[model samples]
Target: MTDREKIQQILQGISKTALPAQPSESLFDAGVLDSFSLVDLVAGIEQAFGIKIPDSDLNPRQFDSIEYIEKYLSSHR
Candidate 1:
């Protein structure tokens, strides 16, 4: 599957709900993510993409949405 598809699957696993229609939609605002789940999201992304996310870069704004997550992965990887 594609990167976005992997992201969506990870999100679904964390949220246990349907993904938001808009890729740019805020996962936090949509109730798809919360403070606790953010850690799981980070772990999922790292495992799926095979990239280690530094603890210093654990800001929520950097991972607020699918678009943002994709951008982060592209830039970091």
Candidate 2:
């Protein structure tokens, strides 16, 4: 699967819900993710994408939505 698709699958596994309709939708605000799930999501991303997500860059804003995460990964990768 594509990276976005893989990310969605990972999110679904962590959140146990369908993904947001819009890429820019807030996963946290919408109850799709919480503090606990966010940690798992970050770790999941690191493992699934094989990219290092620095602890310093673990801002909630960066993980706010799929679009933001994709942008961050695209630029970094």
lDDT of each: 0.92, 0.89
Report residue 36 deviation for candidate 1 (angstroms). 0.5
Q: What is residue 30's positional error in candidate 2, in angstroms?
A: 1.6
* Tens digit of per-residue lDDT, candidate 1, span 1-77: 98899999999988976678999999998889999999999999999999999999989998999999999998997
Candidate topping TM-score? 1
lDDT (C-alpha) at residue 39 in model 2:
95
Models 1 onward score TM values of 0.95, 0.93
- Clashes by residue pair, model 2: none
Q: Please list the Cα RMSD from the true structure of every candidate, rounded to 1 decimal place.
A: 0.8, 0.9
Residue 43, model 2, lDDT: 93
Model 1 stretches astray by more than 4 angstroms: none
